[model samples]
Target: MIKLMRIDYRLIHGQVAMAWTSAIGANCLLVANDAVSKDSMRITTLKLARPAGCKLVIKSVEDSITALNSGVTDPYNLFIIVESVEDAYRLAKGYRNIRSINFGGAKPQKDCTRKLSVTTPVSERDMQLLKELVNEGIEIEIRQVPGDEKINVSKLL
Candidate 1:
């Protein structure tokens, strides 16, 4: 079962490996990003970045959905990590009863607004899409780690 769902642009950075993992007490890390899933080098880098004794699985959003709903009944706490809000929106498409989503990081890019403390600018469309997602009952919050002061999407919007 997924203990936490994290949306971080830097999927396996130091903060993620050290702070978020420990904060959530996650034993297994599941990264759902198309680029990292397709690239062996990135996946290897992520694995190397993780602390010892942490089990990590890098898979696409589709594969993640399969694994998430497979009913395997994992005893270890699982963390689902994704890059963009769009990816989270995509991953949550068919899934049911998901409550909250965390905005970890979304580094700056041209024309992107600083939607959260850690994220850069996002498009108008993305903002709208995220609002719609929230309206559909998915809670969005901006926080670097579990213990960080969380910023609500409604207030931010």
Candidate 2:
């Protein structure tokens, strides 16, 4: 089953490898990013950063949705990570089982108009997508790591 959906620009990094795996009790980490899925070097680096016992699957957002919907990943407790709000919106629209999304580490974009958290910056487009997700009944929280206090994304906007 899908345990958590996280939005972290640097997916499967040190903080996530250490904290989120144990906290969510996830054995599988799915990175749903088109760019990373197509890049061999990024895939290799992500594999090296993954937790020792956890399995990592890097695929495009569409493929990830298909895998989850088709039960290809039903054997393990899955933690899904996406890089951007647009990707997260796509996942939320395509996957009905996702209950929550943690906004972890979005760097300030050149067009960012507001800072949601120290590491999370939002542009108008990002905020609009997030609001749409919220309206779809998906809970959104801003948290850097499992240890950090979760701030509701709605409150930031």
Candidate 3:
């Protein structure tokens, strides 16, 4: 079962490892990112950062979808984290079970044309994809942590 799907640039950090995992009662942290899956050092660092008692599984978006679809991760309460809106869109599109996404942190890009929040800077392309996701019935909530009040992305747009 997927407890939450969050898009945070800093994938498995203190906030996620401590707050979000406990808030969601998630036993598994699934990071769906192509780059992180291939980097040995990055994977090791994330594993080290994860809170004890929580299993960390890093896989590409496609592979993650395959695992979810094949019942490979059905036993655990899964918390899915992706780095970008593009990756979130890909995962949500591939898996119908992901009905909502929490936008945690997105660093400013050089091409950023708009600021969604203090931590989230969006390019025109990012805005479009986000709007499309909303239109497709995926709820978008902008919040730094589980205790914070959720700001609807629709109102921000």
Candidate 4:
């Protein structure tokens, strides 16, 4: 069971390993990204960065859906880490009951709008999909960590 879905390009960084996960008491991490899942070395590095007791599963979007959703009756807490907004959108589409998406970090890119040092560059299609998700009652917040003050995207709208 995933309590939160965080969209961070950096994946399991210091802030996530030390602060957010600790605060949320997330023992399981399901990283849903095609690129990272394909790269064994990157996955190994990410798993190593996580705390010793925490379990990290690096899988593609489809695989994550299958693994987490199957036989889940008690709703165990887990964290879903994604790389981009598009990936988040896709995951939400593939998975249900997804509300409150967290923006941890996105690399600065051309034509991006900066919010709390994180760059968000939305293409026309991406914006449309995001708007659709918002209309479907998804809450979006920009926060680096649990302690970091949250910036609600709805307020900016």
Better of 1 and 2 by lDDT: 2
lDDT of 3 by residue, 1-157 (tens): 9999999999999889999999999999999999999999999999899989999999999999999999999999999999998899999888888889999999679999998889889889989999999998889999888989999998888
- When sorted by lDDT, best at the front, the candidate numbers are 3, 2, 1, 4
lDDT per residue for candidate 4 within 1-157, as digits (tens), equals 6667898888898888878888888888889998999998998899789876887788898887776567452355688899888889888887776788987776555655434343555555556666777888998888877877888766654
Q: Write the per-residue lDDT of candidate 2 for residues 1-157, one digit (tens) a residue.
A: 8888999998888778988888989999999999999999999999999899899999999999899899899998999989999899998888888889999989669999988888888899999999888888889998877888789987766
Best by TM-score: 3
Consecutive 10-residue window with the lowest summed lDDT within model 1: 113-122
| Global lDDT of each candidate | 0.78, 0.90, 0.93, 0.77
Compared with the true structure, what per-residue lDDT tens digits does model 1 show for residues 20-136? 888788888889988889998998899899767789888888887777777552676887889888888877774554577888777576667555454645767668778888888
All candidates: TM-score: 0.90, 0.96, 0.98, 0.87
Candidate 2 weakest lDDT stretch, 10 residues: 148-157
Give me the runs in candidate 4 sitting further than 4 Å from their true place.
72-75, 111-121
The RMSD of every model to the true structure, in order and in angstroms, is 1.7, 0.9, 0.7, 2.2
Instruction: List ranges where model 3 is wrong by over 4 Å.
Output: none
Best by the lDDT measure: 3
